[model samples]
Target: MLNSVNRKVFLLYPNLIGYARAALLLLSVFAFHVGLLRFAVGSYAVSQLLDAVDGEVARRLGQCSEFGAALDMIIDRVSTIALYFAIAAKSARAGLLIFLLLLGDVGGHWLFMYTELKLGESHHKNSAHLPPGLKHPTSEAMHQKLMIGGNP
Candidate 1:
């Protein structure tokens, strides 16, 4: 079913989808701040759906790239952590566990990204078409850059 649709629909508006996802994430945070916990949870779920759909759409449209995937992954991790923290605030025991879990998950993801960058695989796989300027000279360069407060 997905294959039959025109790819242009996805390609023409990836930025719009990204913005919508960001807005939804912001709304979820706002809802939590206002004590509408259920609404916040629902918003977070919707945001996740939007995030997944946008990536799938980008892929279907041949717009997939390592940069986009990395951005999406970072957003997903941050959103999940923020939402979990908000939820945890309502329950002491659950909150502690949630914090620990979030830390582990984020830490693991960071480690994997670090390793991939070191191996020079971060830019070679899904984003081989990236411009020369955007492509890292080598994995070592990427590792050094990342270690020195570079965006990854």
Candidate 2:
């Protein structure tokens, strides 16, 4: 079911899916804030699931451009942060936890990007063959001695 053909179909609908996900997330946040929407949490959860689906679809369809990945990541981060803030506003007592979660989320993304960049560079310089599943390494993994400075 998760084949390339299905993935391509999914990619073709990215704009629709992306917009729907965004709308749902916003609605969920608004509902949560208003205290009238009982299923706001469920809607938010569904949005998150759709976010994952869009990414996997893009990747499997060979539509995984850097721009697309970046866009998706940015959207995901923004939505998550917005939700965190919304919840924190509802309960001031959770402020510290929200702050910590935001810090971890941002820091983790930065670290991963940095490592990927380094690995990519290393792959380009040293490895002759590409990585089994990856298109290319973003940067060389300095810590791993096995990877030569070139493409592999």
- The top-ranked prediction according to lDDT is 1
For candidate 2, the lDDT comes to 0.62
Clashes of 1: 0
- Estimate every model's Cα lDDT from 0 to 1: 0.64, 0.62
RMSD of each: 12.4, 11.3
- For candidate 2, lDDT tens digit of each residue in 29-116? 8888788566788777677767655555554565654445555566677787987897788799999999999999878866666666
TM-score of each: 0.64, 0.62
Model 1 Cα displacement at 56 (Å)? 0.9
Candidate 1 Cα lDDT to native: 0.64
Candidate 1 residue pairs in backbone clash: none
lDDT of 1 by residue, 1-152 (tens): 55634533444454457667778888889898998878887877677666645555665676755546665776768787786778687777796689688988888777766666776764332345556665544334435433542223
Runs in model 1 deviating more than 4 A are 1-12, 122-152
